[model samples]
Structures are given as C-alpha cells and as structure tokens.
Target: MTYLVTGGSKMGKSTWAEDLALELAKDGPVHYIATFKPVDAEDALVIARHKKARAGRNFAVTEKHQGLEAVVIPPGAVVMLEDLPNLLANEVFDDGDVSSILPGLKFLKALAEHFIIVTNEVGSDGTVYDALTGNYVEALSFLNRQAACLSDVVVEVVCGFPQMIKGDGP
Candidate 1:
C-alpha cells in the first residue's frame, strides 16, 4: 500500500501520515526517512519539533538530506517519507540533479511493502514567481503528480482534516 499525503504547511499531514503508517506497520518495523536538511535556526527548530513528535514512537528515523535511492531500507518495511518537496530541492539545488527523483520513488515503492509519502501543496495560491522559484514549483508539481500515480491512496489535508483525494482511506 502506497499513500501519498499532501497539504499546505501546518495542515497536520505528517501527524495523519504517522498514524496511517503505524496502522499499516502493525507489529512490523517502521522506518522514517527525514529529508529536510536544516540551513538556519528556524529550520533547526522545525527539526527539533519533528524529533519531539517522533520521540518514543518506535520509528527508526534516518536523516537523509538527498539521494533517496541510496538509502538502505529493509525489505517489506512500512516507510514514511517525511516529505517530498525538500527532497526535490536537495536533488535539484544541492546535488545538481533532478532526473533520479522518479526512479528513486520507484525503487522505494518496490522496496517497501507500505510507503507513506508526504508532500506540500503549492502553485495553488495566485502568486507569480521568479525563475528559480518558478522552476522549483514546476518540478515539485511533477513530483507530486508522479507520486500520486504511484500511490494507492492519495489524500489532501486541509486545516487538519484528511480529505480523500484518491483511492481508499485508512
């Protein structure tokens, strides 16, 4: 089962995704792939908050800044990708590559029996962007669409509500 959870920031997508991962994991092992790499104090705070939330949750968390294809995940693991947008940023901006994201997704999708992916909702607000930001927005949209295609369940979180966008809900 692959679940793609998406929403704007602070919409409780991560919480809902965590619950769904626990439900799917049952007695099995659950791995969390944290893709956000902090660059400043605010980002550090965000990381801290996420750590606090996951504390004692039985999640074997790995901080992966980039290269999702290189992560060594156990077979049949119920894996939750903390989010996707940052991973795309890391791939394009940090690693100077964008071609591997989809193949990486396919690899993870095949390796894990249950995959819970969380991504952001963007390009919805009527705000024009500059070239770099515009390219990022376009790339992220591509990633989200590809993820939705690969997912068995696609959910959109709105104001903490998990609204089903595709497939069956938990």
Candidate 2:
C-alpha cells in the first residue's frame, strides 16, 4: 500500500513518518529516502537530529534528491520519503521551477509498490504571495494532488496525530 502523509511546515510530518517507519520495521526492512539538502547550519542541525533519532534502526538510507524514482523499491518495504517539495527544489532543477517537479509526480503515481510518502501542504500558508514563492507553492500543491490520487492512504498530520484524508483510514 502506497501511503502519502502531508501537512504544513513544522507539523511533525517527518517525525511522524519516522515513527511509523520504525513501527513497520519490526516486520521487515525500511528504506529512508532523504531529499533535503543542508544549505545552512540550521538545516544541517535538523538533519543531524533526525539521524540521531534513528541512530540504531535497521534502515537503508538513500540520499537521492530528485532521482528518487531511480532507486529500486523493494516490495513490502516501508519507504519513507521526507519531503517531495524539497527534493524538487534541490535536485529537480537549478532554478527551482515548478515544472521540474512534474516528472517526479508521474514517477510517484506509477510506483504501485508499498511505500510511505511525506510532504508539506503549502496551500494554507499565506507567505507564498511573491512570484517565485507562488509558483513554487502552486507546483508543490499540484504535486501533492497527484500523490494523493495514487496513494492508498493519505494522512494529514497536525501536531502529532495523523488525520486520514483519503483511501483506507490511517
């Protein structure tokens, strides 16, 4: 079952995904695909924190930014994707345009195997009024929509609880 978990920034999406992946790991191997780039000290620290949180897990982590589609997804493996939009921002295009993410969306829809996808919900955010920000937000929203369509389960996390928005209840 392909699961898509989405929420606004700082809504504990990553933490939730990690927790769920760890739970799933009890049954089989888990793959943690990290798409975020540490562009600054703060980001680097955040990455470090996540790494520390999963310090002893049996997770095979692949740091493939936009080439997430290239990785071979093992069946029944719980794959956790950190953030689709950030992956598009870092690896899909040098200019960070929305069009670059279209391919990623198509790839996600075509992947019929089991996995867990995570992303930010940018529609409710009011900061994307600028031309660049608005375009990025629009693109991410479209990408999220495509993911939601293919996902067997869609969870919108808030605070720490997950609210199922589609497919089988989470």
Candidate 3:
C-alpha cells in the first residue's frame, strides 16, 4: 500500500504519516527514511524535534539525503519517507536537476510493501516568485502529481485535518 500524504508546512502530515506507519508496522519492521540533510542550525533543530517526537517508536532511521536506490530496505518493511521536498531540493541544488527524483520515488515504492510518503503542497496560494523559486515549484508540482497518480491512498492535510483525495480513508 503506497500512501502519499501532502500538505503545507507544519500541517500535521508528518505526525499522521508517522502514526500510520507505526500502526502498519505492528507485525513488521518500520523503516523511517529521513530525506533531509541538516545543513544549518534551523535544519538541525527541526530534525531534533522529529527525532524527539519518534523517540522510543522503534523506527529504524535511515538518513539518506541522496541516492535512494542505495538504501537497503528489508523485505516487506513498512517504510515512511518523512518528506520529498527536501530530497528534491537536495537534488536540484546538488546537480541542478530534478528529473532524478522520479526514479528515486519509483525505487522507494518498489522497496517496501507499505510505503508512506510525505511531501509539501506548493504553489496553491498562487503567489508569483523568482525564476529559481518558480522552477522549484514547477518541479515539485510535477513530482506530487506523479506520486498521487501512483499512490493507493492520497491525502491532503489542511489545518491539521486530512482530506482524502484518493482511495479509502484510514
């Protein structure tokens, strides 16, 4: 079961995805694939908060910021990808390309029986931006669409409430 959970920043998507993955992994191992590579103080703080939140949850944390294909996930593992936007950003900034993200997403889907992916909902506010920001938004939008199409369950979190856009509600 591939589930895609998307929302704006701080909208409870991560919390919901974590809870779902824990529930699904009651009988198996839960692999928490954290995509963010903390490069600044703020990033480190956010990562720390997430670590605290998942403390004692028995999640096998795999901090892979790039090369998702290299991550060795156990068979039939319940995997939760914390967020996709950071991964995209890393790829974009590192290589000035976002096309590689689609293949990575496919690899992750194939690696687990139950995959829970968290990503951001960009450009919904209709705000104009600079050239680079615009490119990032376009790329993220495309990736989100692809994920939603492939996902068995697609949820949009708004104001801490999950609105099911595809599949049955959990």
Candidate 4:
C-alpha cells in the first residue's frame, strides 16, 4: 500500500500518516524516514516536538536528508516518509535542482511494502515571491504531482480532517 498524504502546514497530515504507518506496522517493522534538516533554533525545536510526539510508537527513525537509494529497508517493512517539502528544499538548495528526487522516489517505491509519504500543498497562498522562491514552489508542486500519481492512495488533510482523493481509504 502506497499512500500520499498532503495538506497545508499544521493540517494534521503527519499525525494521520503516523497513525497509518502504525496500523500497517502490525505486519512488520516500521521505519520512520525523517528528512527535515534543521538549520536553526526554531527548526530544532520543531524537530524535538515531532520526536516527542513519536516516542513510544515503536518506530526506528532514520534521519536521511538525501540519497534515498542507500536506505535499506527490510522486505515488507512499513515506511513513513515524514514529509517531502524538506527533501525537495534540500535537493533544490544543494544543487539548485529538484529532479534529483525522482530516482530516490522510485527507489523508495520498490523498497517498502507500505509507504506513507507526507507532503505539504504548495502554491495555495497565492502569494508571489522572488525568482528563487518561485522556483522552489514549482519544484515542490512537481514533486507532489509525481508522488500522487505514483501513490496507491492519495489523501488531503484539511482542518484536521482527511479527504480521500484517490484509492480506498486506509
């Protein structure tokens, strides 16, 4: 089962994805692939909060910012990719390109039995920004579209409620 859960910030996508991962983990181990690269105190605080929320969830956290091909998951392991925006940003800022994420996404699709991918909905604010920011948003939007197409199930979290857009509900 491959699920792509997406929404705006603080829309409860992560929580819903985590719960789905736990449910899928009943058949095997659960791997939490956290892609966020905290660069400041505020980011660190957010990361800490996520860690605390996931405590006692029986998840093995893998802090991977890139190179998803190198991640070796046991066969049939349920994997939760915390979010894709950070991953896209990392790739974009590191090499000024987001196409690098495609291969990694393919690798992940073949690696896990149940993959729960979390992403944020970009370009929803309708706010115009600088060229670089616009590029970032474009890349993120592309990534999200690719993810949704590849996913077996697609969900959008709005006001803490999940609205299924593709496949059967989890």
Q: Superpose all Cα atoms of candidate 3 onto the true structure and report the RMSD in Å to 1 decimal.
A: 1.3
Could you give the candidate ranking by lDDT, starting with the highest?
A: 1, 3, 4, 2
Across residues 59-165, which tens digit of lDDT does each residue of candidate 2 receive? 78887766655777664567777778778687435554445455654564465345788898887756648877686678778888888877788999998789988
lDDT of each: 0.90, 0.75, 0.88, 0.87
Alpha carbon deviation, residue 130, candidate 2 (Å): 1.1
Better of 2 and 4 by lDDT: 4
Using TM-score as the measure, the top candidate is 1
lDDT (tens digit, per residue) of candidate 1 on 54-106: 88787989898777889899899999998899898888778646888788889
Q: Write the per-residue lDDT of candidate 4 for residues 86-117, one digit (tens) a residue.
A: 98878777773466677788788887889889
Question: In each prediction, how many residue pairs overlap at the backbone (N, C-alpha, C within less than 3 A)?
Answer: 0, 0, 0, 0
| Structure candidate 1, residue pairs in collision | none
TM-score, cand. 2 vs. native: 0.84
TM-score of each: 0.96, 0.84, 0.95, 0.95
List residue ranges in candidate 2 displaced over 4 A: 91-113
Give the total clashing residue pairs for model 3. 0
| Residue pair clashes in candidate 4 | none
How far residue 105's Cα lies from its native spot in candidate 4, in Å, is: 1.1
